[model samples]
Target: MATADPYGPVHTEGNAVPPLDPDLAGALDDLAGIHPGIDLIRDGIRHLALDRHTPDTTQTLLATLAGSSGADAITAIGHLIARLANADHNPALRGLPLDTQKQAQRHGEQAAFHLNDPTLHQPASEASAAITGT
Candidate 1:
């Protein structure tokens, strides 16, 4: 039988953090490595590609994740990184398809480059065009 989630819901401003999908997590881990700090870089990816948050969310989100949970929470972070990276920038191009895999890899590399200092609070938009190529 399926068990209930042990850590319960992860919330940021009442928004529940997305569940970790294994495929997404694997892709992210492949791109960003399995280091714990990889979790912090996720916010950068979100800001750069998805434009979901201010570039400064890294530390805040890291604190949120640190308090909310553990392995599962980190996994969720990795999943989000991969999901944003792998996202198709142009849905209309779905028929023909862009090299989204490459784009995702580019995003992952960009984020991982910042792994050394994820809390630096730099603007994440610098390489948005290069990473997403949109």
Candidate 2:
């Protein structure tokens, strides 16, 4: 099992940090494609946290979650939720029509619900156990 890349390679010299497992990396890529704003929001939060010089609970929690397989999906979903909510309040998003804003809000709510869904957080072994009643 590989680890998460906390410090993404700047020089691009074959990635200085350890890479995430192939499956997790692929899943993260797929999620980013589905929610285009997820990466933007994640990067923004990370930058802001670093700039503030204060404890970043969100970053810390996500890093901890990334330690395990499948947890990155939950973290990505959470970032999508945050992105939607942030866009809804941002002045730039105001330029969008009312219907578009409503759509974004709806997407955010849906993501939030998905984030709260218990099954999303369950490990495969745990899920299998529940299914088999073992």
Candidate 3:
């Protein structure tokens, strides 16, 4: 079924960490559920110190979320990360050559096309195909 690996390799060699999206989603879910001093997490993220801690910061956030009762917080985190992932301000992604970004976007779009199965939505397809006796 080739399920997507949400925490797969980050495209950097030899590092054993999952992608950033999972981490962000996990952290946000925990914070909102616990109602912790999310401001602190925000402050830490704003300072770019997260890069310094490498895996520690991410590990901690994920651990916190794991322990919290707000298990659904991961969904909230995804919402936050989707905003970041789509934002033009992130030079980390936007700095890439336009063609490179376009290629990645195309990959996503193509996957969506298959998953959506446009054939099912065809305007004038034979509705009896499901009951074909021919």
Scored by TM-score, the top model is: 2
What TM-score do all the candidates reach, one by one?
Answer: 0.23, 0.39, 0.23
User: Ten residues in a row with the worst lDDT in model 1?
Assistant: 121-130
Best by lDDT: 2
- Per-residue lDDT, model 2, residue 4, is 68
| Pairs of colliding residues, candidate 3 | 29-73
TM-score of 2: 0.39
lDDT of 3 at 106: 59
lDDT per residue (tens digit) for residues 20-66 in model 2: 55775565566564455767755554454344332344444443444
How does model 1 score by TM-score?
Answer: 0.23
The candidate, 2 or 3, that scores higher on TM-score is 2
Deviation in Å, model 1, residue 111 alpha carbon: 3.9
| lDDT at 131, model 2 | 44
lDDT of 3: 0.46
